[model samples]
Target: MDGTHLFELVIAMFLAIIALHYLAHRLGLPPSVALLTGGAALAFVPGLPAIEVDPELVLVIFLPPLLFDGAWSIAVDRLKRHMFGIASLAVGAVFFTTVVVAVVTHVLMPSLPWAGCAALGAIVSPPDAVSARAILERVNLPRRLQILLEGESLLNDASGLVLFRFAVAAATTGAFSATNAAGTFILLAAGGAIVGCVVGYAWVKLVRKLHDDYLMIAATTLMCWIAYLLGEQLHVSGVIATVTAGLIASWYQHTVMSAATRMRGTSFWTVLVFLMEAMVFILIGLSLRDIVERGGGFGALLETMALPALAILVTIVVARFVWIFASDVAIELAHRTGLARSVPMGTGAATVLSWAGVRGVVTLALALSLPDAFPGRDFILVIAFAVIMGTVLLQGTTLGAVISWAGLRGTEAEGAPMTMSQAEAAMAQVQFAKVKSLAFDTDGNLIHPQLLRRYEHRATAIIDYAQRTEDYVPMLHAHFDVVLEAVAVGRTELIRLRRAGQIDDETLRELERDLDLEELSAISAKA
Candidate 1:
């Protein structure tokens, strides 16, 4: 496509995404599902051009930011607590599912080589990080379950893709070694993580010297791409590298960035992730045209390929359930015998986790990347597409219902209503004391009685509202907005004073930082 046409297509796709997002929000459907359906519908529109997505470009452009943002947002403490469970699912479950799917595919279609089946298995094994997170955010999963899912999605991409590379190589060369592949996986994961840490540390040091929020945002964006590209060039797992950088950056940002910088950087990443996710799903839908065309049309493809596709999809779903339950049982036995320290996994949590394995863009990209000469390439592609659609459309859509049906609602401890109330009460008392203390200046001179009275009244009202009302959140929000407005006005005056030579730039900056910190605190409180 020409540059002009490409630009036009980009604009059109974004517009469609916005429209579909609104529709999905109104219809109470997942945004990914809406985008996928919209893209498919657009494909069938007369005179609309079919846009082919480059799988390599998808990984290089979309994967890094998505992975980094997810890692950055994940709760570090929660992940640490559940590291064992997350590891078993992310690494072990992925390996097990890959093998199961490969066996089933080989049995169903004997003509396809074992290597090809393994490649297909690896392609669809890891749940899509973007899809899982997007759906999980909307549901009311228990805190531990949510963290486990998020952690698994964040790490499994690296494992699944590493396995994919080994399988592809084995298929092409007609040679394979379990020991060699295992060694390669370790080297790639460890090397990628080390590289990410070095890069993240360098970025932290560099950003500390910079004061511009926009510059900080741009620098982090550059860091993600550079980290991924560097890892790929070094023959390590780029997904791991990006995720590592993001986690390190997230931890270090609090120390290095000003409040304003951190807030702006967060907003930038949020918008970027939303756009990337929307584009990926829509593009997946758009590619349906090409897939259908290659198979000589939808009806012909289904007549020949439907049964195998359904079988593969069913196998993946069943494998996840088996692994989750089996692992849980073993963990329980170990705990009972005092051989391991582990919590008992409830049936509800196990069921929800099993049903949450929805495939997405990565699977489609890998399938499309298959060589033309590969055995059963078309058949493999068809099955991959079917599985992606089936899992995402059927399984993704019903996951929340399944969680509810299994009676896995958030527990009282997980909800933490009592803790939240206690915190709110403590915060109100602290603010009330601060307001009362503000009545006098540093010179020990009392502020004007009228102004002092107004501050005291507002503070007292907030405290009473917090103590008496179940719905005090709105009152708190109003109080926060009032403080924010006052801080914003002070910041503007500080800038004006510096511009008029009434204050030096250094003094102005010092005062501005104070205001920024106050504003950040208020915003955080409201959130």
Candidate 2:
């Protein structure tokens, strides 16, 4: 397409996304589902150009940032606590789903090569992290459960992509070996992680030397792309590399970068992720036109492939449910026998987790990446698309209701208590003391007795509120709102002063940044 048409297409997609996103929010549906539906509908509209989605662009441009941001936001402590569950789902369950999908597809389509079937299996196995997290945002779930879901989504793409590469190689070359593939998987995962950490450490050091928010943000963006590209060039898993780098960078950022940089970086990444996700889902829906046209239109394609697509969708859902239940049962048994320390995984949690498997962008991208000469490529694409649409539409829509029905709509009782970190409490105490000291003269005699008394009272209140108990939660929230309001007012005044020429732009910005940092801290405390 020429530049004019391309610009028009981009504008149309954005307009559609904005409209559908608003509608989705109002209707209590996942925005992704709404976007997908809208894009698909647009495909049949006359006078509208077909939007071609390049699989390579999606993988290279979209995947890294999305994966990195998600990984970066994940709490390291939560990952450690739910490591077992996350692994069970990310690695073990992904492989299991691949095998089940391969076996089922092979049985249903005997003429299709086993290798090709395996490739298809790997393509569709890993549920999309973006979709799962997006849907879960609307549903209340236990913290540990949420952690497990998010962690699995973050990690499984690497495993799935690794399996996909091997399957494709085997199919294309007519060669397959389980032992060799296993070794390759280990190398890709471990090597990619090592590369990510080394790169992440270097990137963090570089960022520490930079003071400009724009430069810091630009450098972090480059890090995601560079990490993925470097890992791929080294013949390892780019997904793992990007994920690892994001996690390391996130964990060390506070120590290395200013609070201003962190706050601005967070906002930058949030907008980037939102836009990327919006385009990905809409592009996914738009790509259906190509599939439909290739299969000789929608009706003809459905007539030929509907049953197989339905079967594949059912198989994917069932496999996830089985694996989740079995893992929970094994964990329970282990805990009872004192063989291991495991949190009690109730039926409600298990059910919710099982139903939360919604395939998304990764599946579509990988399916589209299949070589033209690959056996039954069109068929594979159709089935993959069907599974993605079916799971995301059916499961995504009902997940909240399912959670409600299962009675899994609260934070887990057995998980870590919700309390301020000791480090945070200490920092608050220090700040309070500093402020109180400012209310006194250099010799420590109170210059403003009322101010000294007020600071002391607030400090005590904060200290008491920081204690781990349910009773102080409301008081803590009230304190946070008050602090946030004060910071917000300070920011407004700084902006006004700059506009009125009472303060220079530089001074206004510096003071405004301080208030922004304070605001972020207060908001974080409330969360």
Question: TM-score for every candidate vs. truth?
Answer: 0.85, 0.89
User: Candidate 1 residues 1-527, lDDT tens each?
Assistant: 79998899899999999999999999999998999999988988898887887889888888888888888888787788888999998899999999999999999989889999999899999999988877887799888888889999988988889888888898899999999988998999999998898889989998988878898889998999988999999888888888889889989988888877877788788888899999999988998999899999978988988888889999999999999999999989999999998866779889999999988888888888888898878888888888889988998789889988988766433434555555666676676567668867899888766766766676666557657766877787898999999998998899888889999978988888789788989999887
Clashes of each: 0, 0
Any runs in candidate 2 off by more than 4 Å, and if so which? Answer: 412-418, 421-426, 432-454, 466-527
Q: Write the per-residue lDDT of candidate 2 for residues 1-527, one digit (tens) a residue.
A: 89998998888888898999999989878898899898888887898877777787888998899888888888788898788889999999999999999999999999999988999899999999879767866777888888888899989998899899889999888998999988999999999999899889989899889879889889998999999999999988888999999999989887887866777788888888887888888888888888899899978987999999999999999999999999888888999999989856788889999999999889998999999899989999999999989998999888888988888755533344544454456666787788776877888787877766766676676666557547877877898999988988888888888888998988987788778778877888788
For model 2, give the 10-residue run with minimal summed lDDT: 411-420
What's the CA error at residue 8 for candidate 1, in Å?
Answer: 0.5
The superposed Cα distance between candidate 1 and the true structure at residue 469, in angstroms, equals 8.8
lDDT value, candidate 2, whole model: 0.86
